[model samples]
Target: MQKVTLYTKLNCHLCQDVYMMLMELTLETPLEIDLVDITHAHNSHIRAKYTDRIPVLARPQSEVELEWPFTMADIRAFLSDPAPDS
Candidate 1:
C-alpha cells in the first residue's frame, strides 16, 4: 500500500473534490491517505506551508508532494514513480 498525506481545509471546494477523487481512486488503486486539515489551529505551521497549496498529496518517506491541477492519471504516475523535488 502506498501511504500519503492529503493537506486540506474546511469549506474548500477544491479540497473536497480532491478528497473524493482520492476515495474513488482507492477503489482501483491501493492508497492509504491521511487527511490533514490545514486550517486547524494546531497545524499553524502546516497551514503556513500549504496555505496557497491546499489539496496537496504528500508521500511521507520521500517527502514528495503533488499539488493541485492533477488528474487520476497523474496520481497513478505519482504512485508508481518518484516525483521530482517539489
Candidate 2:
C-alpha cells in the first residue's frame, strides 16, 4: 500500500478537484489518502507552508512533491512507482 497526503484548504475548487481525483484513483490503485486542511491545521508551520500551495500531493518519506496543475496521468505514474525519481 502507498501512503498519500494532500495539502488543501476549504472551498478551493482546485483542491476539491484533486480530492475527487484521488477518490477516483482508489478504485484502480492502492492508496491511503490523508487530507490536510491548511485552513484549520493545528500546526502553524504546516499552515504556513501550504497556505498558497493547496492541492499539493506528497508521499511520505519521499522528497518529491507534486504541486497543482497535475493530471490524472501524473497521479497514476506516481502511484505506480514506489521510489521518488532522482
Candidate 3:
C-alpha cells in the first residue's frame, strides 16, 4: 500500500473533489489515505504551505505532490508509478 496524504482545509470545493477522487481510487488501488486539515494545525503552518494549493496529494517518503486541477489520468500515472524509495 502507498501512503497518500491530502493537505486540505474546510469549505474547499477542490478538496472535496480530491477526496472523492481518492475514494474512487481506493476501490481500484491499495492506498492508505491520510487527510490533514490545515485549519486544525497550529500556527497555520499547513495553511501557509498549501494556502493557494489545497487538495495537494503528497507521497511523504518520496516527497512527491500532485496538485489540484488534475485529471484521472494524472492520478493513474501517480499510482502506476511506484514511489522512488517506498
| Highest TM-score model number | 2
Report the error of model 2 at residue 9, Å: 0.7
Candidate 3 to native Cα RMSD, angstroms: 1.6
Which portions of model 2 show Cα errors greater than 4 Å? 84-86
User: What does candidate 3 score on TM?
Assistant: 0.86
- Considering only N, C-alpha and C atoms within 3 Å, which residue pairs clash in candidate 3? none
Q: What's the number of clashes in each of the models? A: 0, 0, 0
lDDT of 3 at 7: 89
lDDT of 1 by residue, 17-58 (tens): 888888998999788888998888495788799999888988
Q: Give the poorly placed runs of model 3, Cα more than 4 Å off.
A: none
Which pairs of residues collide in model 2?
A: none
For 1-86, candidate 2 gives per-residue lDDT tens digits of: 77888999888999999989999998987778989998899999999998988889988878778898899999887777768632
Q: What lDDT would candidate 1 get against the real structure? A: 0.84
Kindly give the stretch of ten consecutive residues in candidate 2 with the minimal lDDT sum. 77-86
